[model samples]
Target: MTVENTLELEHLEHPDHDVVVAGGGPVGLMLACELRLGGARVAVLERRTDIDPTLKAGGINQTTAEALYRRGLLPRAAEAQERRLAEYREALAALGGGRLTVPPKFAGHFAGIPLSAELLDAADPAFDGAGPAGEVGAVLQQDVERILGERAEELGVDVRRGVELTGFDAGADAVEAYTSAGRLRTGWLVGCDGGRSLVRKHAGFAFPGTDPEITGRQAVAEMTGTEGLRYGWNRTEHGTYAFGPMPGRFLTVEFDGPPADREAPVTREELEESLRRVSGADVRIQAVHSATRFTDNARQADRYRAGRVLLAGDAAHVHSPFGGQGLNLGIGDAMNLGWKLAAVVRGEAPDALLDTYTAERHPLGAWVLRWTRAQIALMRTDPHAGALREIVAELMETVTATTFLVKKISGVWHRYDLPGPGHPLTGRSAPDLALADGTRLADHLHGGRGLLLDLAGDAAVTDPARGYAARVDTRTVPAASPEETAALLVRPDGVVAWATDEPADAKGLEEALSTWFGAAA
Candidate 1:
């Protein structure tokens, strides 16, 4: 059924979208774009009337940074970074110096602990500093939403704002979902609707986990009598409160239990009260800016997939935003789910292939849950926890100790234990193999097809790929170095599904392709 451009009519004549995504936030927008890339007709139903420009997520993390780059959106993101960097440099130069000392680059932080550039560099080996200067650091959540929303529209995703998922009735093969505006019919309904996901609840996916012990708030607001309040992460006897680099932006975490009313809109006045509570400061508020609240209310759906309804991003799991991992984690889900669901929707793959989405991503989500929990444990207000925090801080100060945090936070620490493990690169991000013509591996993924980096120069690999030529992008670039690699089959998500340093393994190659891109018939 063809969905029309008109968003609001009495009903949708074409309710048969390949997928109906609930939520217009970053994750949902990204998933919509990915589904579109996979040749699946999608209608993104967002309840929000407008795209939020709130700096809700501070920046994009490593894997997401790579995912955006693979999709050819990195230049735009780099523009944001470059714009900020230039402004920062200019601001510094105006302060008068013989040679303007370069400002300290924002080298990312874990929990509230900052990691050094050296630690960050050693965390992800794949980052060769070729694309987008800096250590694959921050990109505003607002920028991500804008880029993804535009891409989704360009790919013909029927995005309907002010439409929300009220409930879903799952069928054997399709889903009938009720929304605030009307009902939507689709082969699949993915809830990227965020932590308070109605789809997850209505679908009866067991979402069992711990609730919030501490409430966290971050805001860009004005204040008065701010003297003596240092601008940085300040761990006080009461709890943790900090001032952002910019004077207006402030962050505070209080262990006064979760807010009395979670739905209560965070305000600048409330922010000052919390600041005074945590920092014991005589800070006064002069003006108001955007403010928000969060908590370490970590929870994960027992099952991410249930019948025709599936969940991703915050719908699948929720954790503390300590490491800035929520956006990155959600994008990771979008990246992993896009092509698989696309293949299923196109009838190129079996339904069983969709099962891998849960199998692969569930453990990763569980790990992130524990990661947040551990950080929370270390951030206790008591002396015992303070001692532990001190130990952890000392560890973070050391390059070797900090690498662990950097790797996990950067997404280099986890590798999918995919079938047919030949080399370490298998189930990892495909190496940025530079071709003699200066083409990089990520360049081939702009079309959202599977890629086989045939560095072995073996003609045998091309034969298997021919059967799935439409889905698999097979490229045999001359190996830049002898010991670089032999051959690799990369998934659309930039994951190396199969790799071999020897002559092409026809049987193994076929298995990988058939399992991923579907049977070679």
Candidate 2:
């Protein structure tokens, strides 16, 4: 492709958009959808001609599902997952006669940590069921993008494919993005582009981190005769090799082997030979899909925002796919910033709401990187690491240790430290409570609205100056037990902001509004 063809810029004079998102991947599309729902005119600029073929980032955690569920997008997500499961089953059935059964569903606990399962069960009941044990956690990345993109389009988001952002000028008042087609002027510019983000580079943000010594390789292929085996892994003195059923009569293999020489392509014969060596059997292999190699680099940007241009997803952090967190983390990043950005753009909240994006997400990214590195270290075949891996795996099989590790990997153990006194709901996900007006917390939060639970006497809570606050709907539940009477305040991001028997003092209520609901006085 020529330079012009590769960087096809489509410009719009006085574009009708409040935020111009530079990337149409899952994170970008989801952010666009959220922004549109929050009453922002949004546009997405994507460079790809079509969705990626490889099924990357398989699992979607409960937290992510709850986020989507609150947005009323869970039905779509569930449909996509159902389709993927059916495809997986068909693929397995075609290989032989025995029915391919989905594995028992267990909360992903890492390192034999007992806390992980306990945390997950306590957080959400959706995870309380028998299912699969493998990492086929959710639908593929492409399927997620498809669903998000469709939902975004339905929400009146202008998704411009085949267009790439070349440069952006972030000024005090507005951002002028220069793309392959033309210039787009918007209130803000967010870079949801991948790790090799042009926007991040143009913004001059430094990505500070180191790459792991081992390289990860993944390939999807159709083998003539490898049936009866659900999934298997070979951990030899040299390296680690694993393969499992894919969507078609295909199997996906992942190998932690020696890094290939500079930009050298991994041949089909090499993949087949590796399968033979690892499986210890003769297998007919056809390269239906090519193997791709990537380094297990863990890095995050020095900062998430430079003036008005901000970074999220792979633009902000990159790490190994150890916990199947790459996509989930990206979606969470979009969720964390979407409502805050909407509040700022609408002048409902102070610019300080934007500050929390980095404050909150940066730490989570660091945690993910640390845990992913630990998992990678445990999986290494080096003689020194081998001894450590055996000890760690053995320890992980224990209930307590396994649960702790599981929580870390599943991301259920994370709790945001919001400014509030100790309450059951504080710093946790707000429980879905039904209101007197027949509206539930999830229903009201469909469009990224902050909610105040008035469990105290039904004294009206109102702010005449703030439209959202004045129109805030309060639900009064009859006092049951002392445990049930505690009120909960939920932020737009679905995190508990404040909880008490009555409203905090006027000063506390005012501060909560100022921090989350964009009330300024």
Candidate 3:
């Protein structure tokens, strides 16, 4: 049925969207864009009046860039990064007097090791073309949202600002949501709200975790005396101090300590004192853009999905931002869900396919929470905790240990547990390859179709035994080396559900289709 027909005159009183997204941040906007690109009508209900200009997430990893590229928003993201890089270079040049030479390597979220070009190569293949500037990550949260939000709107996503979702009713066929204005119905509802999520609360999803007792102090300031001093960190007699660059004339410093009363202001003297004590430099602080305190809480929803209502980003999990994984993880969640939800909404797949959203994402969220908590614990300044930190940090420096950690923290090592013969491509993300048609693996996903890659020319391999062939795109490729010949059937979300050296078995193909595309022909 057409969208206009689905919403009759009676339904005209309230706007009806194919999918109602309950947040307008990076994740929500990205989800809306992806759904819109997939031919699903989407509407984003944002509580905020306007976009926030604060530079929150300072870096975008290669994994995230690839995900954004798949959605055809990489050019916009790259442009934003270029602007931020110019500002960052200016900040570094001012810090270094008049002349500035790029350092050999700079410290990153990973300690001791400099972010050398070699390190980027070893990290991921996606990092091959990414330059060794601005930490292989971009700064500024506003830039990210601006790029995504603009792209979302350009893609025809209806972004409704100043509208808040107060409650929602999930029915068998549709979800009815009640907002401040009135009631609206949609085929699906996604809660991308942040930590204080109203949708998660109204849906009765349990967020299980504790808020950290220690408070984290973060502020952006203008620095006059400090130039050319690469980002630094020190465990002072008072507490932990970290300073990094921001756009324009701003620098951000974060300190850890007991929670200050929300009404109390963070004085410049306090910031100056902390800088002096930690860096042993007399640094002058000018204007303070924003100052806030936060507790390190590691919490995740019991289930990411509840009937027709689902959660993504901070709405599903909240943890310390030590690793800067919050935004990255949230974006990943949206990328995974967008394609699956679109398939179901288009009636190309059964609703049961949506269940995999929770099965595949829940455990990963819990794992991230545990890892983030451990990283935060290592930053503690207590005497015993300090000793433990040294031991763990030292242990992490070994090649074996560091590689293990790099894989985990980079999120490249994660593989979903899909049922199969344990093919190389099974459960792993399909690597981007230069295809015979001169297209990339990510390019095929633009059609929002399930791809069945056949390395060997065997049509019988993907023969429809019980309603499979009609639901997926099966193609053949010439056999190459073990590495090259390995076939990969990727889902719209970029996950490889079926793969093999030869053609995939009929049973495996059937199971994969039913699991991801549902039991639809």
User: In lDDT terms, which candidate is top?
Assistant: 1
Report the number of clashing residue pairs per model: 1, 28, 4
TM-score of candidate 3 relative to the true fold: 0.84
Off by over 4 Å in 1: 1-13, 86-103, 118-135, 504-507
Model 3 lDDT tens row, 331-382: 8899889888887787877777788889998888998888777766666556
lDDT of each: 0.80, 0.69, 0.69
Candidate 1 C-alpha lDDT tens digits along 1-521: 12433465455634769899988898998888889999998988887777775548867776887888889888888877667667656655664532335536555565566677666444346444234423556567887888888788778888887777788789997898787766877999999999999888888999899989999988876676666587567788888876765446688888888989989977767888888888888988777667788889999998878877889999999988887789989999999998899999999998898899999899999999998998888777999988888888888888776666766777766688899856878888776666776787888988889998787678887788888888898888775555556788999998989888777655588889888988776
State how far residue 324 of model 1 sits from its true place (Å): 0.5
Top TM-score hit: 1
lDDT value, residue 381 of candidate 2: 58
Q: What is the lDDT of residue 411 in candidate 2?
A: 56
Our model 1 lands, by Cα RMSD against the true structure, at 3.1
Model 1 weakest 10-residue run by lDDT = 126-135
My TM-score estimates for the predictions, one after another, are 0.93, 0.85, 0.84
Show the lowest summed lDDT stretch of 10 residues, model 2: 126-135
